[model samples]
Target: MRQNLNYSYPQIFWVEGRPNLGTSCPSAPPIAPFPPPVPDRRRKPKNHTERRSVGLLVTSLLILLALTGVGLSMFRIFHLEKELAELRESASTERIPPALEKLIGQKEQSMKKEARKAAHLTGNPSQRDLPLEWEPTSGHAFTSGIQYCDHGLVINETGFYFVYSNVLFRGSVCSNQVLTHVVYKKNPTLPGSHVLMEDKGINYCMSQKTWARKSYLGALFKLRKMDSLHVNVSKIALVNFEESKTFFGLFKL
Candidate 1:
């Protein structure tokens, strides 16, 4: 059975002004905050006169350096020139003097005289200052040591010489060898340079036959001219104008 409703229900009306508490619409998107403003930087002020003055100062420094280098170079050049001039002057003043030249000449003469005397002592005593007769001035018997036989006086030392009594042979033949000697002659006006020997006669050989006979064999050397005489050596015969021979010998006084 339907019983009449006696209880009263609470009424809910939909109003536009207020929303329901349980249900909610999407919240409006949160707004982004504005960015902070950047501050302007301050620049230093320029001075035109100061920039020009600094440029001038740097240029002046460079110019001063160049000038200093040039001054040093000039000083060095002047110094070198002065030194060269002094050297030239010194050389001119130190040249040999005339009086000194005379003294040198005298000394040279003295040396020559001594040398001639020495040459006389060695052997090949020149006949110019020697006696013709055999006198034992050299303390050695001329005949005892005489190894060569010749036609003329063989000067061995200044005062001593060998004079052969007779000539055996004065001719030349073919020889594979030869001997040489220096003959000294007086260089008149030149002190101590006097001497002469067979060497002075070498160019006189007209033919090979003459050379073998006239060639200055070792034994034929004058005592004083022995120094000038070279021994029997190889190739001497080659230069020799003489024809080839097996053996050759020279005898002296």
Candidate 2:
């Protein structure tokens, strides 16, 4: 019965008024196994790059510390140097010692004394004829034989005079053997032997005792004008102890 096909029925490709999308769609082609979820792997880090970064950091720190230490030391050194310079400058401007000033004064006085003496001696025409004797001090007593010395001054009762010659030792002449202090020795004939002038030779009244050789016989003449004793006498008595001979030489007067 072609009767009344008017009854509404769902279309094959449409559901009600909307078209059907695909309820099963052939199972989506099996999804290719989802490519195993792409393995979820992570990329490896650059080991050399990381190591180099750490090393660079450490080296930079070390250099920075070293620089800091050096800078500090340099600063301290500069500070100390400035202080030392200031101290030296201050010292340079400071006053000298009083003792030093006094020493300078004494030296000037000595110069004046010498100048006066030289002027007197130089102008005196008869100075050559005047006898020069060593000025003796009041308290000091000359020991045995007269000795001339090149060094040392003796101040005694008379005045200040330099010794003519050093004392001569027996057998040989030695500086160590030079007579210095003087003392007296007792003898039956001479009564007592006297020693005087520590380093210079001794003089005694005893004529029996042998006299030592005089090294400064020449100096005796120069001293002649110093006193009134023997200004005209230019000859000095020299005794050769070894040969037991007595001789005389021209005086330096």
Best by TM-score: 1
Q: lDDT per residue, candidate 1, 1-253, as tens digits? A: 9999889655544546654444445766878998887655575567899999999999999999999999999999999999888878868887546788789999988775444322111122222222111222243223322222221222234333322111112346544333343333232234553333333223434556743333342222234442221122222323322112212222332
Using all chains and alpha carbons, the TM-scores for the candidates as numbered come to 0.28, 0.28
Residues 191-225 of candidate 2: C-alpha lDDT, one tens digit per residue: 43332222245442235444454333222212222
lDDT of each: 0.40, 0.36
Deviation of model 1 at 209, angstroms: 14
Using alpha carbons, what is the TM-score of model 2? 0.28
Q: After superposing candidate 2, which stretches have Cα over 4 Å from the reference?
A: 1-45, 95-132, 135-193, 197-253
User: CA RMSD for every model?
Assistant: 16.3, 17.0
* Error of model 1, residue 23, in angstroms: 33
